[model samples]
Target: MLKELDLARREAEVSSLAQAEQDELAELREWLAAPEGAKDEHRRIAGLRAEVKEWQETYKKEKASWMRAICELTKQRDLQVSRADLFAKQLGQWRDIFQETDLTNLEQEWDPESSFYANEDAERRECQP
Candidate 1:
């Protein structure tokens, strides 16, 4: 009777161990099937990575647009500066011509082909429509 009880205890221990292993395997399978379905660490990290990628793409597009705007503004500013310089030079020439002539003298002769007036025809044609 003692030997039989010892054998029965061994068998029960073996069955308990097997049941524990089977339970562990089932839990592993369920975990694998729904790893992303749960709000676990893996899911949170994946969501963060996707959000970071979207922000990076958006930043790249916005940076490109900002650089283009800066380039356009720089070009416009350069054009205006050059135009102002050209107008200043023309104004200086006209001022010199004015200083040389006496507007109050009635007998003074005005020659259209001399001084600032000589380039007026060509300059008028250069002005765009």
Candidate 2:
């Protein structure tokens, strides 16, 4: 009877050790799976951050280009207005000369197609600056 009891105790101890080993293996599996699952999430977040940074840099460059274009256009527009003003002043001087000259003599001396007014209009239309 005593020998049977010792055998049973030994069997129970072995079963307990096996159960403890299984529990430790389960904990290790859970820890291993956790790192594997988290790796994908970490990589995805890193990719998103990189994309956002690229977009931010693109926007900054675009905004700077837009500002430069706007400034150039403003300068061109100012120059055009100044040219128009100078043309108007010259026209006024030409009109005064026309009024002072004798019409019959002017007709003989000047061709209508060769007038300053016609040339000025053509030049203004041709020259963007």
- TM-score of every prediction relative to native: 0.51, 0.49
Model number with the top lDDT: 2
Candidate with maximal TM-score: 1
Error of 1 at 38 (Å): 9.8
lDDT of 1 by residue, 1-129 (tens): 547856986797689669868865775666577746563864565568569768966986797688679879999999999999999999999999999987786446666677586688778878957
Model 2 bad stretches (over 4 Å)? 1-36, 104-129
Q: Where is model 1 poorest over a 10-residue stretch in terms of lDDT?
A: 37-46
lDDT of 2 by residue, 34-102 (tens): 777876775576578569768966986797688679879999999999999999999999999988987
Global lDDT of each candidate: 0.76, 0.78
Candidate 1 lDDT score relative to the true structure: 0.76
Clashes of 2: 0
